[model samples]
Target: MAKHHYKVGQTVSGITKGYTSEGLGILYTEDNSRFFVKGLIDGEEAEAKITYVGQRSSYAKLTKLITKSDKRIQPKCPVSTACGGCQFQHIAYDEQLKIKRGIVENAFRTIAKSDHPVDECVASPMPYYYRNKMQIPLGLDKKGNIISGFYRARTHIIIPTPECVIENERSNGIIATIRALMKSMRIPPYDEDKRSGVIRHILIRTSYYTPGLMVVLITNADNFYSRNNFVKALTKAHPEITTVVQNVNKRKTSVILGKRFRTLYGPGFIEDDILGIRFKISPQSFFQINPLQTENLYKIAIEKAEINNSHTVLDAYCGIGTISLIAARHAKKVIGVEINSRAIRDARSNANRNNIDNVEFYTADASDFMENEAKLGSKYDVVIMDPPRKGSDEKFLNAVLTLEPKKVVYVSCNPGTLARDITLLNKKYEIKSITPVDMFSQTYHVETVVLIERK
Candidate 1:
């Protein structure tokens, strides 16, 4: 990192760009070469400071937007840009969908064009308050006061938020209660720089199946407070909270979950119902943030899978068996593979609760499972994958190709990685159609469903 030379009020010309990870950063110039910014968008002139000067590209921070984009809107949340939870809150909701659509199309044209051209991007029906889970980080200000909020983008520094627009009113109320508790207890907030703290983060999950909420406290010290007092306070304050647990995370890392967790109150899990399917989700389980949009996404994925009584489907990265249970109704057998044993257990429990006997879940890496299954001469008619934002690995893509499934319904959050994998699979599959679903409203992130048929 070099001394930021680009001062405020300095006008610099740059191009607007859209990348997979780094949101719309500005493409500036220095020494007659191009330098890109990380926290900027297109068509906006900003008084920015060059944070880093690298061999290829430089990073800059926006100080002032001299000329803003027409799509820019008054961010609903007070801590919009600072909060890492969302990326496109400053842009208009309608424009956010449009930009996400462009992101999906660009990925197809650039990475998966050899297969078949993408037709249109599907826009999400609802944009706000779609999130079902929210993790709030606990931090301290300069005065050593507790500040429970979200981290700033690309930084561990906590941006204290009075209210979050993405979270539900119930979830937000939990946040408020936690804040009040911290103030009442007068506990020292976590200090990232000094590495001395108590509470690190708070995890909350809610569903319609349960009357109470699930609360997990992540902390370093073991003797922070009496477990009885903590649980008693929480139970009295919020009786709807049927579950509460304390997660011990001593390591100085950014990840939420740690190695050990202890139940402080009620059961160790919460139940979430989806399309008549019931699932048990723990603190570590991976579920979709937006439940309503997820219904739409799953509907599209199941439809594309083309389930029948005779068909066998494979659901890869099937967290809590959300798709497996749904597909089980139509398919003779649905096999779901996941890396997390916790999620696998949840999926199995979900299947049993839903009375879907046709689905089987395994706690193994999907790519490895598929490879071994292929060697054993097993095959599936339809394969559905919902990978992380980085997309599927090369090995997974190759396994799917080798198996030669009749159809593949690929759901992706990151368009670039999805495009790259789709390009590899294009050798044996024809790109049938692409639909972009706007799950996170007021955010640049888009969920895309790509339908591919055997060539």
Candidate 2:
């Protein structure tokens, strides 16, 4: 390997040209080499010290802002720089929308090689305090005291946070109560290195449209000493809590939840309303974290679907029938497929609870289900897919091409993968419109809804 052009601890100043995929501002040095700097906005001249020198690009920490951009603002959170939770907190909200739109447009142009237009990102109604769910890791601070907060960027070290601005406000009190209970009860935070200790993580979920909250205590062992007392204390302190669950995970893994769950209070689940439809969210269910933005995203997807009483819809990777049930109200029939059995069970129960008979759910891989459906000559007038951040694979795209749905609606979290998948499907479908939604306001993540029609 050759020596890097930029040396560690060296300071340089340049104008920020643009943002990288990870939301870091990109600056070009005099030698035309790139440096990725944190806490910067486009069109700003900044001085930064090189932290890490890589083969292609160097990483830097912003030392001083010589010329600040108009989009810069004072971050609300005190630990925004070190928390690594929100990347665009320093940038204005309106400018964040434009940056996200540019991200999507660049992905389409560079990855998909398509000149399709991407509209401005739809702003969230409530940017701060909009998150309905939080999974906080429990660990010991420097003094060996129990602490609860999110992990620092690219490290296991926990950044003690008594409050997070993006998460639901009610969660702060709940977490504080749980942390105090654990400390009083002498419950040790799980040590990943030793694979020992008691409490691992605390998962909290709240409802925006209903008065209910669910707490799941993830532990290293099934036995939680005086678990009943803990539950009672939580419920007494927070009357809004409707359910409490204890999940066990003995294996030394990074995954949060375990296979077995023991309900300590209520129905082991909490109910929430989305677009007037009730959904039972359990400890393991994959529901949207932001309810306000979810409603907006679903409305756009449903509108782009153009569902009618005469249409049949296929919802791929449908988690808990959130989208399928919503579409059933406007479509004749809807079939939802998911790989997780727990999600499928919740989906079935939700459909029945909503008294929706036009929708059915199956537990299977989305691509496999679509492939088998194509072989069976089953046709769907509309197809709706909300895939994971990795987006759809080639097999799924091939199956979609075979089905030849009149209209396809794609809900994507990662624009890069979305562009790649769209390119694969472009062989049979033509892009109509792409609308970006601000699902995660402060973070670099953005949700996009795209509509495509058969060519």
Candidate 3:
């Protein structure tokens, strides 16, 4: 084994490995040195390069495919590897589901060391057109053409996206219109260094529960020449566009949109009905992108909790009260708590617009609220937590355990953290059901809902 450079021709009989947070891992080599490999799959053998030397493990790169895994497939996107948006697009959807489910299982078994049985993977119903929202970045390509797409995987550089196959047809149409309008107006693109441009990005969202479309233009300033022109063309081209708004992100940052906004067209909001409940989405509020699937997800949570008119429910991390509103119809009282003040305002307004009198909104950190509730000996018959990708923290999880609710519905985007947190609560709670819903298709992300009963 030479130390300076590795011959790409050299072959190593090693199994392709799985990954955790950092990167893929290989089985320990002879002499007990772990090899950290990249651009390879689990249960595969390939010729690799010793890219870098490390204390505990050596980093290697795949040069030749020695053995191919059954899970591998040709990625659909030409720039899949370069673009960071979709992680498992190369793998077949079925294979991707298997790998994701295994990750969830291992997180519980190996990391958390729990005895709960991880169920089979539940795949997405519609792999394409599952995305109702898309935020297209605006920049200039190498050819000096204005580009609008997602950022390349892990870089600040933008990848101009002309066509996105995974989003709804209307979204793709809007993107095309934006591109054509830019070409027509010849609006100069935003320069990251100089911080000057007419447009920054375009956020397109559609509602499965409503017939209307929402288009929000995120720009650096209120330069209304091209934006006004674009809006005219967009609404004229697509009658589905019921609401169009402009978001002013004057601050110097890569964030697409800011809080300050102005309505360009329609009533400042789009109405959507879910589970016999109506919701009005404001520009800044948070709502599930995949509306149809979210209906099922909320239905599952509401059904499993056995919510009744006599039960008092507390919904933590409730964005715009999507769940709390649905739960309100069945529960005696529902309190939706969130840290975003804007979201809280939207939640309250949504409840008011829907004429829901039982549901209330609270602006506070979720974990802090749970801890304080525990200290006050306050108990809720039902508690629903739909945390972000990180899942619930230890303080919140422990506080929830002490509350001893009749049923706890945990909705999570990241299964690894959900499994880990479930293991910690296994001492006081029994795993009743684990249902995985595919909110994001053509992507590796999964939305899992778990029900726990106090033992």
Candidate 4:
């Protein structure tokens, strides 16, 4: 409909930033064009090759590095740009924090129409190797050899990342062991084009403070060659593996896990200890990827809720009751609800495992739970909701308003959706404070915690 500033396959040199008072061009091209830049940073006079141009966004790759920014450093991950998992690995860590804060501030400024004073991003204790979980796709590389790594940006091509610094250190070794075993055993990697092969993906979850680790091998079929011996060899190599499960996904879909699962080794799940509460996480359970930041996040949430001995709390979308059990320690009672029955079962088990009698859980949608509670004239002094990236819907927020909780603490993973949700909640609540946490260190994504008061 209109003339575009850049073109695909065109090599542009040192495109200047569309300047703003907040100086928000550290990683993007201009204020108007939503640009996804790789191997390129602002303030560097380098030439980048425009790869893909879309209606609302564009992508560019640095063809040649004429000059480097002052904040750019040698990325720790060997497959930094190839993997596309962490875009900010090259930028200095301190600069990354500032960029994340600015992102949240910008979302609030443009979407929420609120000049909220966002706090400095809370830094992760371990900037590198902080992720407690890793999911790697299994496929044959160009040489027709079995390999496991992350997919390339926007493509299904696999980039071998043996030394990815963001993932847990032990993950690489386990992947290598599996690869070697597959090679020796003549098991082929999954071929997407042919829709043949056995292994599809490998998902690993490691406990932050405990000696529990689980490995899940996603396959296209239930049975494989020498399954018993394979499990034996895998366990012998990595004694830290507490459990191993096999998930079967036969459909030709992009989704990783299927409906059926069979335990090939010890238990079907693993447990992690955080904030003095033990959480049982199954393969499908929605747990935080960064355990170190998750501890800090839960602490910040509980503290911001300002729960007293006399207060009652509601935890919506509570997976495994991480926040509910933590809040139960400070409040008189806590109630948690989720749509996934499996997560509710784990939450109840977690509560009983920790002897937390004050917290209760239900297998129901959060919005429905809130609406029913409002209709029943039940009240909660504080409500803590950790919604998905899309954030909570308006019906849930409206129900929350009817409940009139004195304070609401929202833990958001996506800033854009957080701002949109806040605008809806503004009809009944006023923002008090906002804080960003560096849950994902090397990536552009951020986790934010906001506290609101009923008007």
Candidate 5:
């Protein structure tokens, strides 16, 4: 490989041209070589020190800002730069929407090779303090005292934060109370290196539509000494806490939750309403973290689906039947499929609680279920899919193609993978409309809903 033009610790000055999908500012040198600078925005002239040199591009840290962009604003969180949670916190909210829309449009143009016009990104109702869920890792600081907060950018080092701007206010309080109690009780944080200690993580989930909260303590072992007192103290401190659970995760892994759960107080789950449908949310249920944005996203998705009483809908990768139960209200019948059986159980319970008789759920892989349905000559008028960040795979897209649904509404979190899947599906379906939703405000991640029609 050719020698890199920029060396580490060398200072370079340039005007930022654009922002990358990861929210880094891009600046080009005279030779057209690019450097991605963090904590910088587009159209800003800045001096930065090279942090790392790559084959094609270099990474830099912004040192001095000569000219700031009009969209640049002060971030609300004190540790926004180090927390790695919200990448676009410095940008104005309106500019954030524009950037996210550009991200979707660029993905389609570059990955899908389509020049389709994308709608403006729908902004979240609450830009900050919108997240209903929070998972804080427990670790020890240099003083060997208990520290509970988020990990730093791309590393396991904990950044102690008493409050996070994006998390629900109640969740923050819960975290603070837990940290205080852990300190009072002398509960040591789990040592990943030594593989000793007790608490590993603390997960808090707050209800958006109701006055309910679920606190899950993920520990390295099942034994939580003085567990009842812990629950009593937590509930006494925070009356909003409706449920408390202890998840035993003994494995030496990065995953937070475990297979076994023990409920110490109230029911094992909390209930929340989304689009007038009450959902029983357990610690492991895959509900959307941003409830308000989720409502808007689902509304747009259902509108684009154009479901009617005569329509039969297939909701693939349905998590707890959020989309399927919502679609069942308008469609004649809805079938929801997911790989996690626990979510399927919750879906069934949610449907029963809502008294929706037309929806059915299956515990199977989405693609596998679709392939079996195709073999059985199953038919449906509409298909709705809300895939994870990686988006749907080719096998899943092929299975969706085989079903020959008249309309397909794809909900995607990753624009690149969505564009790739759309390119493959475009061979059979015609792209109708694409709408991006700002589910995660102050972050680079954006959710998109696409409508496609049989060609």
Candidate 6:
């Protein structure tokens, strides 16, 4: 091992060379040592204090600004710098789009080893107040005051962010109401250290195309105290609140949601419309956070798929059958598969609610289902896979290859994993086109959709 040139807490000045995919600015000094920083832009000169140094790189906290990039702007939210929910809130929106495109291009070039021409990122219409859902943690301050906010960047410590610029305005009111109820009702917040208290977290979901709100109270116990009065008061405070569900999380882990659930009022779910199709959203189901951009993202994805009346589309990870129902209108038949039975239940109800019979949904592991489809000699003309942040596995990719769909439409959130999976699928499929959509505004995360065809 060798001694490093800089020590922790020592401030060093450097010009930013570029940005990492996680929206951290890469700075280089005269010694060629690299440091990753946040809230700094390209060609910006700044002095940053070293926080942690590793073998090849280090992370720093911005201390002083020497030269500011024109791309920088005044952040809308006061706690934007501390909240882990958003990055790039301090940068210009146009420049943020450029950086996201660069991120997608860099991932494909460096990881996939392809010089594919990446398209410009599709900007969201409402960059601010675009988020339809918010999951905030609850705790008590030192004075035993109820606090509701998000976690600090890379840490579990909550930072009070009541007026998040990206979330719906009603979310703030809902949170404020809950906090008041916690204080008045004498409900103590869950203490992670001592594993005591009651309310753990709260998830509020709002819809744009529809008129409904869903409030999911994540609790530390199954039996809520004064359950009827609590529900009545909450709904009365916010008349828009259509459904309220309780999820008990007694586990000693960091994960927020638990397996047990019980609906206290209403249908326990809310319906949102996308692309002329209605979807029933559950408490824990996976759905796009931004409604307007989700519409654009799905439109771009479907346009790239280019399905016809003769085509059969297979939607993997088809939560609530959003894409499946939309594609069913254009394709002859669409089959959706997902592992979450609850999401499958909502997906089926959505299909029936819309009276669309051309689509069928199955609750099964995508990899296992596709592999068994291979064994059964079932075929599909087009396969649309919208996997999680980890992307698809080799087993799923191999199964996709075995199925030999004429076209593969991959929708991904992580560029690195998307590029890696595309590299493997490239052996059997040729990349047709790639498009990036700004699903998450003021964040480093970008949603990319790739269209591939059999070589």
lDDT (10s digit) by residue, model 1, range 99-202: 77777777677766643555445555556666767888887677866777787877877898888888865777777777677777766556767888677788
User: Each model's TM-score?
Assistant: 0.90, 0.97, 0.88, 0.94, 0.98, 0.98
lDDT of 1 at 328: 88
Q: What's every prediction's RMSD, in angstroms?
A: 3.3, 1.6, 3.3, 2.7, 1.3, 1.4
Candidate 6 on 1-455: residue-level lDDT in tens?
11287888888888998899899999887677889998899999999998888886688999989999889899999998888988898899999999999999999999999998999999999999988898889998888889989999778899987787898888899899999988888888899999999999999999898987999999999886787898899999999999999999999998889998889888988889899888888888888999988999999888999999999899999988999999999999999999999999999999899999999999999999999998898999999999999998988899988999999999999999999999999878999898999999999999999999999
lDDT for each residue of candidate 5 in 164-258, tens digit (9 for 90 to 100): 99999888888878878988887777999999988899999999999989999999888867778888999999998999999999997888888
Query: What TM-score would you give candidate 5 relative to the actual structure?
Result: 0.98
Give the better candidate number (2 or 5) by lDDT. 2
lDDT of 4 by residue, 1-455 (tens): 11286778887555534322222232344433444556555666556677777875565666776776788899887788688587788889898888889889989999999998999999999899988888899888778888788988778998987777988898889999999998988778788999999999999999888888999999988899988899999999999999999999999999999999999999899989887788898999888989888999989998899999999999999988889999999999999999999899999999889999998999998998898999999999999999988899978898988999999999999988899898988978999999999999988889999999998
What is the C-alpha local distance difference test score of each model?
0.77, 0.91, 0.78, 0.85, 0.90, 0.91
Number of clashes found in candidate 5: 0
* lDDT for each residue of candidate 2 in 1-455, tens digit (9 for 90 to 100): 11365689999888889888888999776666778998889999888998888886678899998998989999888888888688989999999999999889889999999888888899999999998889999988788888988888888778888899999999999999888888988778899998989889999999888887999999998886887887898899898899899999898788888899999899898889889999999998989998988999999999999999999999999999999999999999999999999999999999998899999999999998999998998999999999999899988899999999999999999999999999999889999999999999999899999999999
lDDT (Cα) of model 4? 0.85
Which parts of model 2 have CA positions greater than 4 angstroms off? Answer: 1-4
Displacement of residue 260 (Cα, Å) in model 2 is: 1.1
The residue-by-residue lDDT of candidate 3 on 154-173, one tens digit each, is: 58777666667677778977
lDDT of 1: 0.77
The window of 10 residues in a row where model 1 has the poorest summed lDDT is 1-10
lDDT of 6: 0.91
Model 2 vs truth, CA RMSD: 1.6
